[model samples]
Target: MNKLYQSYLGSFTGLRKEIWLLSLITLINRAGTMVIPFLSLYLTKSLDFSLEQVGWILSFFGLGSVTGSWIGGWLTDKIGHYRTMAISLIGSSLFFVLLQVPDTFWTICLGIYLVMCVADMFRPAVFVAISAYSKPQNRTRSVTLIRLAINLGFSAGPAVGGLIIAHIGYGGLFWVDGITCLIAGLLLLKLLHPKKSVEEVEAPITSSQSAFSDRSYLLFIFTMILFGFIFVQYFSTMPLFYAEVHQLDEFHIGLLMGLNGLIIFLFEMPLIKYLENTKLSALMNVILGFLLCGISFLLLNLTGWIGILIVGMLFLTIGEMIAFPFSNTFALSRSDGKKKGSYMALYSIAFSISHIFGHNSGMHLIGNFGFAFTWYIMLGLAIIGILLLLILRKKLEKETIEISR
Candidate 1:
């Protein structure tokens, strides 16, 4: 038992202290991420807004995320990741406080846009910082560590958020969210040290001028969009499926969602550590991940039993464990360190696009066709995604070898 504990601890060895600190910062910020997840409910119940108004407000937030991601990348290259992150955290916190004031439709919509725009700008900076702080070999592990922290916080946030909502209401959620962001920003500002020289912080001339100019990265981005389009259905359609098909209550649905985080937290780091230098390439793992995700959904069609849902979710969780972190590592490997922000920003945009495309497409399919057809469509996309990914793997392997050389 002691040896097992020691080995688990050993997996975290050789990571820079900054990476651990960053993970803590992420945990602090994400733990209070109450407002966005429950935004629609708050709008409908507390502010007395209609469903249409809520949709427009949430849509504006999504637009803000897309815009913020691009601008964050641009700024990270020109400024430094540390400063960009500090600005994003502090600036976004102020906006969240302002978000509490507006009750009218246009006013609240504008507030949501501004809040998301500032809040989301931290993402690219965080990705760039992870690359900057860790050695190349340890990069994937570092990214996974932060993701683990995020999942932990995600598991905690809603439960704590529910309590606050019950007793203190919507305004309490905003206050807690804003305060936590402020604390995270202040801690990050005090700890993260960038080089003093301008030359050290800026991108080199040889780095790709823009992410769009690189054809291989563009193909990579396309693959990401395809996978993201399917994977994101977990957030949008999966819950509806659980409620409608399985006849699960809200508490049961929460338990199933919690299971994803629990499994990832327990297994992902060790799994990545085991796989790190193996014969299994990152590309193959990603393909397998997608395959498993599609299979998980298809498993739903095979049975009406709730146990099948748990089994399927376990597969989906494992797929996420393999795919998401390595995808970031692959992107970081392909990018010049100085221009990493831009490359990662493009990657982040794929997810943002997925948020819009995936949910709408799932709802449309389910509405027009049926639940079974929707799973079938996802299965078909996953198969196609695997084929494109095979082509992408060659370019990625070539690029990785070049980087090593």
Candidate 2:
């Protein structure tokens, strides 16, 4: 009993100062992002844009992200995390407010697209900062804190946005998001400045794809692409599955998202603590997350009840808990030297590619295959991912041992 109690306490108690700072960083950054949930709604309802135009605008967002991350990673290698992040935050905020400016279709698309890219730049810079801040020993803990902060921000955003929109209007959401970004950017610069300064100035972060000849890094990136493809269904496909096939309402849909965040917030610490020592094992966790995600679609088809959605969400959330921190830790471990910035950028590249494939494939699958068939197809994808990941088990174990040395 004492052991159990100690274990529980130990999970949250031993976090490093860096983890705390990163958590606050994420919370503040996400706090500023009231634009996410209401983005599509605002475009359609308030801006008088059609669904087709909204889709085009959203694609620009992704395109901007791809460009932003790629460029940001390069800049991080040349400059450093603190400066890169500060620039990204300040620059992105300017772009966010540009969304509210009335203009031609292409003009609005270009503006919003740039804002997305600025946001994307923050992704690798944030991860690379964590890698630089903590040694390999506690990298997973650092990442878990960031992930938790993002979810916390998500849970907080809707409630706040809903109330704010009630008073300020939808256009106000973009302006507020911009203001928060500016504030958060200043905070991040303050938070990430290294305490013990070496006399020699540090070189910036970098990521040359040709240099990624480190097979482990490449493999990890590839696997993440697959996992991301499967994981993205939560935001995209899951809602349609719930509403169209199961005949559920918006209330249940919102509740399911809330429950997923709550579950992750409550349990992510314990889960990451348990898995902190098991880096290579994260491959299996990611595979399992995909399987759960796959089966979640299947369950929705099988069980018509709203409770089934909760169950499916629980499975996906658990999978996320297991997979992400480990994957993050592994990615950073490879690029631990002077080239860490570039290395982290390579990791971001996988996610960008995965976003394109996942969103396109999800729509295609659900459209033609029908709901249940899509789930079955996703199940097959997960199983194949597991098999592919097993091939890397030996290499990952060796990597972990080397990091310890």
Candidate 3:
């Protein structure tokens, strides 16, 4: 038992101090991520918006995210990751605060779009920063560590946000979210100065191809967009499912959502460690992750029992744990020094695109066909994603062989 405990602890060793600090910043930023999780609910219940209105608002959020990601990548490549990240953090905080003022449908939609545009700029920049900070071999673990921080923060965020909403109101959530982002941004500036923290580690140059020109990578990105389309339902639609279908309150829904983060926080690192030791390729692991995600949604259809929510959440959490870090690693590996931000930006953009379509489509599906049909649709999308990933793997293999010759 002692040996097992030590082995689990050992998984986190050898990561750089900068990576840890970055994770800390991410934790702070994501800990206040109360808004996104409850946005649909806020629109539907608080503002009394129609489901269609809510869907359109969320799509605007995605549009802003897409804009932010593109700009962030451009800034990272032109200016640097440090400045890009700082700007994103501080700039987005102000917009988040502005979100509190907008009560009408169009106003709320515009507000969300602006906030996400500034907020999501942080995504590509952070990915570039992670690549710069970590050793090549340890990249996956480094990404996992960051994800751990995110999930850990998310574990606390929802429960607290739920309580705040219950007692104080949605206004309080915006204040808290904005404050945290400001704090994180300032903390980042103070601690990780550009000269000291943004040091790039030595890594072999694999490909200098622009992300735009990489056909296989583009296919991979498309697959990820599909995956994001399906996976994002957790944040956008699943909360509504809990409220309407299971008749859960905000607090109970928060607890269940928090459970997903808690599970990932506890198990993901050790699971990642175990996977890293195996001969399985990253793409294969991603495919496996997709399979689990599909099964998770399918599990919801199998039973009306509330316990199945927990069970399905477990599957989804595990799938997320497997998919995200490896995807980061794969994307990072495909680029070299100057192109890193562009590659990661496109990667971020894929999800941003997913958000535009995923949330609105999901809400429409639920409103029209019902949650069971939505879950089945999600499962079908996941299957399609898996098939696309498999094709990408084959193309990647062919490219590798040709390169070797």
Candidate that scores best on lDDT? 3
Clashing pairs in 2: 76-205, 77-204, 77-205, 77-206, 206-342, 207-342
TM-score of each: 0.88, 0.84, 0.98
- Please estimate how well model 1 matches the true structure, expressed as its whole-model Cα lDDT: 0.79
Preferred candidate (TM-score higher): 1 or 2? 1
TM-score of 3: 0.98
Instruction: After superposing candidate 2 on the true structure, give the runs of residues whose Cα lies further than 4 Å from its correct spot.
Output: 1-6, 38-56, 102-105, 162-169, 196-211, 242-252, 277-280, 364-370, 394-405
Q: On residues 197-267, what C-alpha lDDT tens digit does candidate 2 reach at each position?
A: 22122333344444378886687678777777777667656656666777754445545665666777778
* Best TM-score among the predictions, by candidate number: 3
TM-score of 1: 0.88
Candidate 1, residue 263: CA error in Å? Answer: 2.0
lDDT of 1 by residue, 1-405 (tens): 999888888888998888989999998988878676566557766898754555456566666777788888888888878888999998887888778998899988788778877888888888988877887778899999999988777667766676777777778888888998999999887876675223223334474567788888888788888888888777656766776788865446656766787788888898899888688887788888888888988998998877999998888899889998888887887786337778888988877676556756776677678789999999898899899989988876797799999
Question: Ten-residue segment with the worst summed lDDT in candidate 1?
Answer: 196-205
Q: What is the alpha-carbon lDDT for the whole of candidate 2?
A: 0.71
RMSD of each: 3.4, 4.1, 1.3
